[model samples]
Target: EAAVTQSPRNKVTVTGGNVTLSCRQTNSHNYMYWYRQDTGHGLRLIHYSYGAGNLQIGDVPDGYKATRTTQEDFFLLLELASPSQTSLYFCASSPPDGSNERLFFGHGTKLSVL
Candidate 1:
């Protein structure tokens, strides 16, 4: 089975602070993505990486950065957080190895910036 897990499922921060969300996939997926889900809006891509040490900026990359240190792990960083950045973030993986070819998502991390 394909499984993606995230840490710090909930977070609260000040208007200008730093927050980190971590995700790991047991399936060794090659493509991983970070996205924030807002009310009544579709999932907005924050960042993505094809493999370790490769970062791909996405639509909502502002105020956010990402790192892929290992084939199984992806992390999202919010350097200077804001209330606007407060939302539910999800991590997903698309291994594409015919084992877990579909996008599998983590439960999500709920972030709130005051």
Candidate 2:
């Protein structure tokens, strides 16, 4: 089975604070994605990448930044975070074929901005 690990299970920060969330997958998946889950809005994509050093902007990319440093590592950066940016963040990895059914997700990181 594919496994994804995320650091800092929970976080609390003030407005304009800087935050970095990390995710790593051991299954060697080619596609990695960052998403934020909120009430009413459902899961909204923030960013994604198919390979190292590549990033694709997603639906909610205004307040987020993502980077794929290596095949197994993807990072999400929230610079100048605001209260509206506070939500449950998730990291997921999928096979090269980009099948949603084959995606593996992390436990998630809850972030709160005060």
Candidate 3:
């Protein structure tokens, strides 16, 4: 099974602030993703990467950016964060053959933008 870990489990910041969420995946998965969980929006993908130095923008990309430095490391950056961006963020990893591969998610990172 894959293992995912996130840092700064909780974060608090004001509007127009900045926050960086880090994630590491132990398994050598080909795909890594960052997602944000909100009430009505459900789980929406913010960014993803297929491998090192690769990035793919997701459904919501206004205030979020991500980079995959290595197969096991991925980072999400929130520049000029806003109140609406406050939510539970999750990092996940999946194998290449996603048809039957299950994603492993980190505990979660709760961010509050005041």
Candidate 4:
């Protein structure tokens, strides 16, 4: 079975604060992604990694960064964050390659900035 889990399900931060969201997958998948889900824009990819120590830039990598320390762990880092970056952040994992298949998402980390 495949599963993704995130810490601090909810967060409230002041603008320009530092935040870190952690993710872990049990499937040992090689593909991991970080995305933010907004009201109507749907899920926008942030950063992804193909394997440990390997990072791939995505459509929305600005204002955010990612690190894949292990096959089962990935982390999203937000430095100098702003209100615009506030959204429901999700972490996902897929098979070795993005097989044009569905992604397994974490419960989500709801972030609010003020």
lDDT of each: 0.93, 0.94, 0.92, 0.91
Q: Each model's TM-score?
A: 0.94, 0.95, 0.94, 0.94
| lDDT tens digits, residue span 23-106, model 4 | 999977889999999989999999999899999999989899889999999999998889999899999998865464668889
Ranking by lDDT: 2, 1, 3, 4
Across 8-113, the per-residue lDDT of candidate 1 in tens digits comes to 9999999889998999999778999999999998899999998999999999899999999999999999999999998999999996556666898999999999
Per residue, candidate 3 scores C-alpha lDDT tens digits across 23-95 of: 9999888899999999988899999998999999899978898889899999999989999999999999998
> Clash number for every model?
0, 0, 0, 0
**By TM-score, who's the top model here?**
2
Predicted structure with the largest lDDT when compared to the true one: 2
Candidate 2's residue-wise lDDT over 1-114, tens digit each? 779999889999999999999999998889999999999999999999999999999998998988999999999999899999989999999988735547799999999999
What are the clashing pairs of model 1? none
lDDT of 2: 0.94
Candidate 2, position 29, lDDT: 88
The segments of candidate 4 whose C-alpha lies over 4 angstroms from its true place after superposition are 98-100
lDDT of 1: 0.93
Q: What C-alpha lDDT does candidate 3 achieve relative to the native structure?
A: 0.92
In candidate 2 the C-alpha lDDT for residue 33 amounts to 96
